[model samples]
Target: MAKLIVENGGPLYGEVQISGAKNAVLPLMAATLLTEEKCVIDGVPDLADVKVMKGMLENFGATVVDDGNGLLEITASQIRTVNGDRKLVTEMRASTVAMGPLLARCGKVVMPLPGGCAIGKRPIDLHLKGFRALGATVIEDDENEQVIVTAGPKGLVGDAIYLDFPSVGATENILMASTMAAGTTIIENAAKEPEIVDLANQLNKMGAKIKGAGTDTIRVTGVERMGGSIHSVIPDRIETGTFMLAAAITRGEILVKNALPGHVRPIIAKLKECGVEVETVDDGIYVNARDKELIATNIKTLPYPGFPTDIQSPFMAFLTTVKGKSEVKETVFENRFMHVNELNRMGADITIENRIAYIPGGKTLHGAKVRATDLRAGAAMVLAGLAAEGKTEVSEIYHIERGYEKFVEKFTGLGALLTRVDED
Candidate 1:
């Protein structure tokens, strides 16, 4: 296990570079299975999840090479097997993404149930529904807890599919599966996140005809084949938002490089509402919180173009020292407030009722040993630790490493007194 030790009351005052979006790159990696040619991706983040995805691709007879300069070359000339490693597939929720391409390529796929953070029950029923709608037979092996998807002898035939909820994972799975289907596929109520748009753009580059990505409705016209192409991943909007809040929480000034300001407009508006100054600079965004007192603000997590659910935790951590009460409502994940208890341990006044959290600000937080429940929660703990009065130790840092690349290095570059400690 690894833990992070953070010293308190240091204002981060330097430039920090944002990495590629984990959510975007994962689906893009799975998309490589759609072609037999080499697919080269640039600006891919070096994270634990990326490494896991690389290993999974290798198991399926694909060659993935990292150039150590933010470039990944992938080629899936032939698929050696339809069965994936049970342990690896079960360890990452993104592993389920492979099922779509495998079914399209091999007419069948058998994989164990996917798993990741224990935030809540993220059922893949929507994904299975979309698969079934596309003329594939889905079977549940209850005894083994595995899902089996097989295409008929005629292969997949496209149809009109409507999702009960606009799940990002389901949308990605169905969209990828439809690329090589027999006919046109219309997806209603699809996810409109920027990551979804990025995936659609990449698929288009690979010769798949996809349109209306950043909207509720998506249309995919199936092609006979797809070819690989070079593409660059988008910057991590969630990481950018986290750094912006880190500045506000510690009364710091930071310039976030390679940031897409339009993607984080909601967060920037919220920070400005809390009395933080944000400006758009060339190729980056600069945030200043020096000599500023944060004010409590109400926030509600929604889909893109609204406040992002991934950033709610770190934003909540910043609100702890505000002079008034703040209300935070989480509309995405059910168990996202798992960090409330951990934050309370650090002398924060927070009470959660159902999906809503009421935070009475102005509490002076002191250092305490806290465990990171999930990825975003781990970020919240780090932000709280940066503003607390004493030294704080954050355990279970593997969750943090799954998404963020060079987390400690980036924070240290921004003048944060944080270090990683190995516990054997």
Candidate 2:
């Protein structure tokens, strides 16, 4: 295992360039199974999850070539198997996305239950429901813990599908599958994340007729065949928000480049409400929190265009030093507050009752040995360590690498006293 050792009390400075979206790249890679031509994706981040997805695709007989830059040329000219690797699927929940494209191309797919973070129970029942609505027979082998999906004799016939919740993964899986259906498909209450819009844009470039992406309703007209297209992924909004919170937590100044300012409006609004100064520059955003006392503010995590649940943990780390009491309500994942115990261990005054976390601010945090319960929680621990007064060691950094690209290098570029150390 690798651990991160962070020295406290260093204010981040200088400029940091944000990477491409992890959420967008995974589905885009899976979408390659929808075509037999060569699809080139630029600006793909070099991360653990991306590598995992690439390996899974290779196992399915796709030829993936990396240009040593951020470009990936994926050619699925031949698919040898419809069965996904059980171990790989268990390593990443995103592997479930293969079901859509695999069923569309091969007419059948069999894979083990996907796994990733231990945050909460994220059921794939919604995905199965969407598939069933699109004329696919979905069966679960409870004894073997596997899922098998097969299209009917007439193949996939598009129909109306409604989501009980705006689950991002479910929406993506259905949307991709519907693109190759026989008729039009309607997805109600779809996820409105920017990454969804990015995926839709790429699919359209590949000759898919998809409308109303980034809206409550999405309509997809099935196409006989999709040609290859070159597309650059959108910048990572979560990574951008992490850097912005890093600036505020360290009371530093940082200019974040290659970030979409409009994508993180809710986060910026909350930062301004907490006495942090944020301004939009020509191609990036500038953040300054120097010499300012942060005020406590209440935050509730919701769907896109609302406060993101992904940013909730990092924001909680910042709230520890605020002037008053602050409340964080997590509406997305039930077990997301696992970081609260770890944060409290570092001297943060926090209490959790049900889904709400009460943080009494103005408390000075000290360095402590902490385990990163998940990806976002690891980031929160790093933020807390940056603002603390001693050495902080964060273990289980593989979770962090699953999302962020060059995390330590980026933070170090911003003048953070952080380093990666190997632990045995």
Candidate 3:
């Protein structure tokens, strides 16, 4: 176990380098499985989940080499097994992403239900539905707690699939599976996240034809085979949002480098709404919260181009240091409000009813022993600790480390005093 000890670090004043998108890199790692040649990936963040994916790929007999500096060389020349490791599959939710590539390449994939953060009941039904539409068979073995997917005799044949909701994972899974299908596959009501566009771009580089990636609809044409290619992942927008909130909470100035301004437009807009100064420059996103009167703001979590659900908790923490009241409605996940109690532990005045969080700002928050109930929640705790009156001991920091790379180092670079230490 690990814990982060944080103190009121005062106003931060420096630059922080944003890491590669953990979400984008995970799906991109899965994309490497679609080909047998060598694929080089750059800007890969050093995270636990990435290590798990690398191990999962190695489990399939793929040779993955770390060339340092966020560079990875992966070659899935031969797959030894179709059965996804039961232990590894249950460890991380993104493990399910390998199903599409395995099914397309090996014609069969067996994996247990994927496990991830307890944010919501993010069911794999959409993914299975898309798989079945692409001429694959899906069977749920409740006794063993695993899903078995197998391709037909003629393999996957593309078909028009419509998603009830724009699920990001479902969109990527279906898009990857349909790449080698016999015909054209059209996905309507697809997730329009920038990560999806990154996947489409990478797939297109690997000889897959995909269009309309950053929109509600996406089209993919089947090809005979796919070859490996070198690609660099986009910067992490969720991390970018967290850093922006860090600046706001501490009343500081931070120039977040390697950040994609377009990817975090919602956050930038919301910060400007709260009277915080945010600017987009040729290099990266710059946030100045020094001596500004940050105010309360109502926010509702939605998909891309909207306020992201992942950054909601961190923003809520920032609001606590402001003056007035704010409302946050979470429609994406039912259990995301778990962080509210932890925040309240730090002298925060927050109440929840019917998935709506009522937060009255201007509270003098004092640090306390808080547990990181989840990833983003952990980040919120860190931000809260930075602005709190006293020392804060944040437990269960593994969740934070799983997503954000060099988290403490980056914060410390900005003069935010926090340290990660091993706990006995």
- CA lDDT scores, all candidates in order: 0.92, 0.94, 0.93
Instruction: Give the lowest summed-lDDT range of ten residues in model 2.
Output: 5-14
Report the number of the highest-lDDT candidate: 2
TM-score of predicted structure 3: 0.99
Q: Model 2: residues >4 Å from true position, as ranges?
A: none
- What lDDT is obtained when candidate 1 is compared to the true structure? 0.92
Better of 1 and 2 by lDDT: 2
What local lDDT score does residue 8 receive in model 2, on the 0 to 100 scale? Answer: 73
Clashes of each: 0, 0, 0
TM-score of each: 0.99, 0.99, 0.99
Off by over 4 Å in 1: none
Tens digit of lDDT per residue, candidate 1, span 1-424? 9999988847889889999999999999999998899999999999999998998999998999999988999999998887888888877899988988888777899989988988888899999999899899999998998999998778999999999889899999999999999999999989899999999999999999999999999999999999999999999999999999889999999999999999999999999998999999997999999998779999999877789999999999999988899999999889899999999999997999879999999988889999989999999999999999999999999999999999999998888889999999
Model 1 residue 317 CA deviation in Å: 0.3
Task: Give the range of the ten consecutive residues with the poorest summed lDDT in model 1.
Answer: 6-15
